[model samples]
Structures are given as C-alpha cells and as structure tokens.
Target: MRVEEIMSTPVVVTREDTLVKHARDLITRKDVNAVPVLREDGEIAGIISVSDLAATHFDDKKVNDIMTKMVHVVLRNNRVVDAAAVMVKHNVHHLVVMEEGKVIGIVSSLDILKTMVD
Candidate 1:
C-alpha cells in the first residue's frame, strides 16, 4: 500500500505562532505524540513532538524554541515500506506527509503499527 492510501488525513497541526502551553495542550487533547508545524501559507515548516517538547526542559521557552526545523517528510504517494524505513532510520515517531510541498497529513509509528497489524 501507499502512504496516501493508509495515512491519516486532515492531520492535527500547529502554527509557528502557537505558544508552548497551547501546543502542549493540543497534544494532550488530541492524544497525539506530535504535531506538524505550519507556516502562514500553510506550508510544512517544522515538527514538534513530545520528545522535542520534553527535550527543552525549560518552562519558559516557546514552541519555536523546541520545535525541530529540519523535518523528515514523505510524499503522499510514497511506498509505505519506504516511509517506514525512513522513520526507523531517523528514529522518529512521526513523519509529515506532504503533497506538492504542502502539509497533507502525518504518519506516526502507531499508524505504522496499525498497518502492520491490520
């Protein structure tokens, strides 16, 4: 199967301007481990994960301070196997799914597990 066929769409995302507290709240409310960071034009800017949040270890820093600017992404049409390999190689739980350079969705390790099990 392709990433597009299995990936979750309309992903939960965060804006660059969103505060750390709000980002944390969104993650908790959505019950997701990570959220993709988007720019004003709705482009994929970066990614903010629970690990990234915790790595900051500062109560005062903002999301921008902790979010990873260099994101590892997969094209929506990519093979699920290729995406899985990237995730494993990068040691990342989430990969931003893009289409024409825009954020389309996100694929998490949990999603991959579900694919494997199903």
Candidate 2:
C-alpha cells in the first residue's frame, strides 16, 4: 500500500504563534500525536508533538517555542514501507505527508503497525 492509502488526512495544523495549551487541546481533541506548524505563507515551519508538550512546562507559550524545526516528510505517493523506513531512520514516530509541496496528511509508526496487523 501507499502512504496516502493509510495516512490520516485533512491534517490538523497549527501556527507558530498558537498557544501551547491550545495546540495540546487540539491534539487531544483530534486524537493525533502531532501537528505540523505552518508559516503564514502556508509552508511548513516545524512540528509539535505530544511528547514535546509533555517535556515542557510552557502551556502558555507559543507552539514555536517547543516545536521541532526539522520536520521529516514523505510524499503521499510513497510506499508504506518507505514511510516506515523514514520513521526508523529519523527515530521519529510521525511524519508529515505532502503532495505537490503541500501538506496533505500524516503517518505514524502505529499506522504502519496497524497495516501489518490487518
């Protein structure tokens, strides 16, 4: 299967200026592990994850303050195995899925595991 086949779509994203508390709430409500931080011009700036939030004490701070600037991404057309490889190589749990230079979805390690189980 392809990354797009199992990736979560309609990605939930956040702005750099968004409050940490808000981002955390968004993640909890959406049941996602992370969200991509986007620039005003719609480009990806960084990423914020549940682990990032949990490791910090800045609920009132901006998302940018705790976001990981180096975001790993996978093309939507890539194979699921390729996505898993990226995750393993980067020691990351999630990756932003892109298509035509635009954020389209996200894939997590758990997603890959679910595919294998099914």
Candidate 3:
C-alpha cells in the first residue's frame, strides 16, 4: 500500500499564528493527537501535538511557540513501508503526506501498525 492509500486526509491543521488555546480546543474537540501547522504561504511550518501542549504550564502561547519545528514528510505515492521507515529513522510518530508539494494527508505510527496487523 501507498502512503496515500492509508494516510488520513482532511487532517486537522492550524495556523502558525493561532492561539495555543484555540489550537488545543480544536485538537481536543477533534479527538486528534496532532495538528499540522501552516504558514501564510500555505506551506507546512511545523506540527503541534498533544505532547507539545502538555509540555508547558502556560496556555497563553501561539502555535509557533510550541510546535515541533521539524516535520517529517512522505510523498503520497511512497510505499507504506518506506513511510514507516522514515518515521523510524526520524523517531517521529507522524508524517505529513505531500502531493504536488501540498500536504494532503497524515500517517501516524498507529496507522502503520494497524496496516501491519490487518
């Protein structure tokens, strides 16, 4: 299977300037673990995960203040195993799936494990 074949699309995303509280609410309401951070140019800037929000005692921050600066990206057409390898190599839990330079989906470690099990 390809990354796109199993990746979750319509992923929850947040702006870099978005308030941390709002981002946190969205993530909580959506019941998602991570939200991809986007820049004004519509490019991925970073990623804000549940851990990022929980790491700080202050809630009055912005996405840019807490987001993981480095994001691992996988091509939509990449093999699932290749994407999993990227995650392992980078020690990341999730990867942004890009198609034509645009983020279209997200693949998590859980997704990979489910694929393997099923």
Candidate 4:
C-alpha cells in the first residue's frame, strides 16, 4: 500500500503562536496523535506530538516553543514500507505526508500496524 492509501487526511494543525494548552485540547478533541505547526505564511514549521506535550509543563507557552522542529516527512506516493523505514530509522512515530510541497496528511506507526493487521 502507498502512504496516501492509509494516511490520515484533512490533518488537524496548529499555528506557531497557538498556546500549548490549546494545542493539547485540539489534539484530544480531534483524537489525533500529533499536529503540524504552521508558520504565518502557512508553511510547516514543526510538529507536536502527544509525547511532546506530556513531557512538558508549559501550558501557556507557544507551540513553537515546544514543537519538534526536525519534522520527518514522506511523499504521498511513497510506499507504506518506505514510510515505516523512515520512522524506524528516525525513531519517530509520526510522519507528515506531503504532495507538491503542500501538507496533505499524516501517518503514524499505529496506522502502519493497522495495515499489517488488515
């Protein structure tokens, strides 16, 4: 399967200036593992995950202050196996899916497992 086939779409995202608490709330309400943090120009700046939030205590801090800046990404057309390899190589659980330089979706380790079980 390709990444686009199993990736979660219409991704929930947050802005750099968004409060950590708000981001946490959004993640919980959206039932997502992570969210891409966007810059003022709508460019992806970083990614924030549930682990990141749980490891910190800066509810009032900005997302930019805690988001992981070195985001790992995979093209939508990439194979699921390749995406999994990237995740394992980087020891990451999530990857932002991209198409034509634009954010399209997200893939998590759990998503890969679902594919295997199915």
Each model's total of backbone clashes: 0, 0, 0, 0
- Model 3's number of clashes is 0
Backbone clashes (count) for model 2: 0
lDDT of 3 by residue, 42-94 (tens): 99999999999999766788889989999999888899999988888989999
The alpha-carbon RMSD values of the candidates against the true structure, listed in the order shown, are 1.5, 0.8, 0.9, 0.7
lDDT of 4 at 88: 95
lDDT of 2 by residue, 3-105 (tens): 9899998999999999999999999999889999998889999999999999998799999899999999999889999899989999999899988889999
RMSD of 2: 0.8
In model 4, the Cα lDDT at residue 74 comes to 96
lDDT per prediction? 0.85, 0.93, 0.91, 0.94
TM-scores of all models?
Answer: 0.89, 0.97, 0.96, 0.98
Best by TM-score: 4
Any residue pairs clashing in model 4, and if so which?
none
Q: Put down candidate 4 lDDT per residue, 1-118, tens digits, no spaces.
A: 8999999999999999999999999999999989999899988999999998998898999999999999999999899999999999999999999887788999999999999999
Which is the winner by TM-score between candidate 1 and candidate 2?
2
- Local accuracy of candidate 1 as per-residue lDDT tens digits, 6-88: 78778899988788888988999998888999888888778999888777666456677789998999998898899999988
The 10-residue segment of model 1 with minimum total lDDT is: 55-64
Which lDDT value does model 4 have at 98? 83
